[model samples]
Target: MSNLATKKLSGLLLKQLGPHHLSSTSAFHTSISNATAENSKPMITGLFRTFILELRNHSTLSSDELMKPVQTSSHSAQGKSEDQKDQKAISSYWGIAPKKLTKEDGSAWRWNCFMPWDCYKADISIDVKKHHKPSNFMDKFAYWTVQTLKYPTYLFFQRRHVSHVLLLETVAAVPGMVGGMLLHCKSLRRFEHSGGWIKALLEEAENERMHLLTFIEVARPKLYERALIFAVQGMFFNAYFLTYIASPKLAHRIVGYLEEEAVNGYTEFLKDLENGTIENIPAPAIAIDYWCLSPDSTLRDVVTVVRADEAHHRDLNHYASDIQCQGLELKEAPAPLGYH
Candidate 1:
């Protein structure tokens, strides 16, 4: 018989309705509209002015262990401090690189990429200027990935299965999300942006690794289902990211939206940890959080730092909009989830 554990994840996802998410999204839409309103570019300096005050209450209170994040790093070379080393572990989960933009209203006319590469797949080592050169392997890889991951969000939405199914689903899904994030991180690397994003993704990747490992460690270890999830996530994200490189606008916004959502989920997870209401880490509800939010609780500081990366996503969205808006007039209406 199908246990309640499988259905449990679905129910938990439906329960969150908080102001941080609503306001942040709303603010995003409003800012986008303001930028393009009147065919005018507003000075972007003050856009993030109230960032700390605005989101402070929304942030989860930190634990004594996770207070610094520096104390959380794994062993590394160059003798970097723990925080710096820890920063190197979670690369893809941070959403610190370029983002994907989607219409909150669920409009299909989404922004694809900011720089417009077309994912032609030439030599992967080529500079951004040569991205359009089109290699057969890259194009083929992107296509396969999209086809495989066609149902990520949908599959994630499904409820009622088994404990092994849940573990398999989560293990499979996390890596795809991690890889998608890595592609974005690499985008920043290509653009010569700061190493901060790279560092963040590394940490996130580590987090994904932990979750995957944890699922594997479970008594059942549903290897077959887990494999399916991995393949789907891997394929979908690679293709999605290739498209993102090609268009780089709304695609990035989608990324930003997802990351922000992840942050919200992680922050909530920490809150649960604080309350005795969330007793065991392996509780079915907690497992859902593991699958959907972040899987890295080994270092509580990871939640704060990873969430900070989500906060920084707003800046990237603003930057991408500015870059992509070459004389295009932005309408003054807000879109769903804060797209204008």
Candidate 2:
């Protein structure tokens, strides 16, 4: 008895499953105007639907539930409300929203480098060429550190600015990673967040390392200079670690001054390139790839981007110092995670 009834129902379904039957649904509509008209029409015809349901073998489910699969494509716009409810449930089941953007709204990732690309390209506006007098003991110490490093660079690597940059970047990359690591440990120990400082500092470290990598391709430093880089990096890393542990504010101020000097150095380098004192050769392939530069990028273009990055770093360090000066922690304010 059950087999006979199942065969009858199967034959009925087959009869209704023709191409013409599909035409009765809206999915294969050929014209936009007709599709729109079909979409606007009401789906429910109570009398007709009831009459069709009475012919079915089992009438346990409603008409809407029975037709759900076929209507899915046509009802996409209408399904948004249903999706919202499901999305809310899913978001609660997970910790965060699935579709949330990782970075700020405007910025996105660069393809080759996998670094954040600033959509609103901010220009370097700070006049780093101007010198500031030391106001307090901390300021004086910061000033002294920057001045102490300047003369050796000038006397030893004269006209070898690319090599100078390679050295600077090697040292510059250390502070951010150290700071980020320390902050990460502190946060974990205290069960507190560092706002966004850990990510921001790590990103800065990565950016500075990229600068080092780019310049290495262009500069090709001698054996002695590479040895000098090793010496300077080892000494500086230990000194900075201790200094940061003693007073983070003073350490940040020192970095700010260091970045200011970097900006000045790059400015002079740019001037030489412009005045034909130094040849503006094609940019390093790594620089072109990392910065998303044009195929015809030059040394000047690479310098321009590096200068802008230094200016941004200068501003960030100064801001961190200011936050510390006010007797507030860096966690009190949000860090600019994707400023680069």
Candidate 3:
């Protein structure tokens, strides 16, 4: 064929094939080159070179048209791009779209910190006064450690219940995350099931985080308090991580004692609310939804449920420590899933 005729043919072929077949054309060119190289046939090699020259010329001329389809695809992707832009500081190409959620009443679920299925009514009937007396050296050591931490915190926050509980929840959420993570690694290393303890501990962590979120709606922490939390969380997370690695028994025991202190703290908060020392304001909307409380529930009711939650946590940690004291791995016992 003449040079002009060959160029025309390649252009026509590209037009007929459309943009999607451009990659196939490149593949065909590659295969032809490989075949020509192997066969060392002069006629075939000449034809292949001519074809490559025509394709290159045609590609330059039709570049705009080829890019049209790509532009159309990019336009289609604009919606996803816009969605990602709307999300602050979170850009991902993983296509992990968020699901729209609604409450039973058909209202849009507002909280991303938790989902509807995570919400549950507190077992207010759980014995808040239940105390695990430290019988052994380990138990006593844990109790005193918590006590040593507790008195200083009480003196610092004084009767400022909101600030006190805010800090409490910050520290409270740590052990579960550390325990869950260590257990997860252990499960992977040992190539055995975690007896649901990983999920249980993670559940506790998320629950405690929800508590912090709920309280945040009620009271914005002071700058100093926020600084305190920053310092405390950094110190506590590393400390607890090391402690859990060294001795899970002692770690769990300490958490149990800490929960006991939390229960006491919230109890004191309730008493203040009851005596009108602190106003019994309407419960934060997050708290009401999280605890599945009545629409008209008050701060008093929120504190009641939160205290009950602490009690359950206290029991769970004490139970964990007790199991360890019996000289068995946590995996030996079935985890109390959804204990709170």
Candidate topping TM-score: 3
Better of 1 and 3 by lDDT: 3
Ranking by lDDT: 3, 2, 1
The residue ranges of model 1 lying beyond 4 angstroms of the native Cα positions read 1-225, 280-302, 313-318, 326-340
Least well predicted 10-residue stretch by lDDT in candidate 3: 31-40
Using lDDT, give the best candidate's number.
3
What's model 1's TM-score? 0.31
Report the C-alpha displacement of residue 17, candidate 2, in angstroms. 49
Clashing pairs in 2: none
Clashes of 2: 0
lDDT of each: 0.39, 0.75, 0.86
- On lDDT, the stronger of 2 and 3 is 3
Candidate 1 on 125-193: residue-level lDDT in tens? Answer: 212111111134533443344345334633653431233233333532343344336545665667643
TM-score winner between candidates 1 and 2: 2
Q: Candidate 3: TM-score?
A: 0.77
Rate residue 268 of model 1 by lDDT: 60
> Given candidate 1, what's the lDDT at residue 15?
42
| Candidate 2 structure quality by residue, lDDT tens digits, 1-340 | 2444434543465366544333333432222122222433222233235336444613465545545555565587678768877666455644765343333435443344444442234355655555445788988989898999888988887877888898889999998988898889989999999999999989889888888888877868789988999999999999999998889989889988998888888998999899999899999866766676777989999899888888888878888887998899999999998766
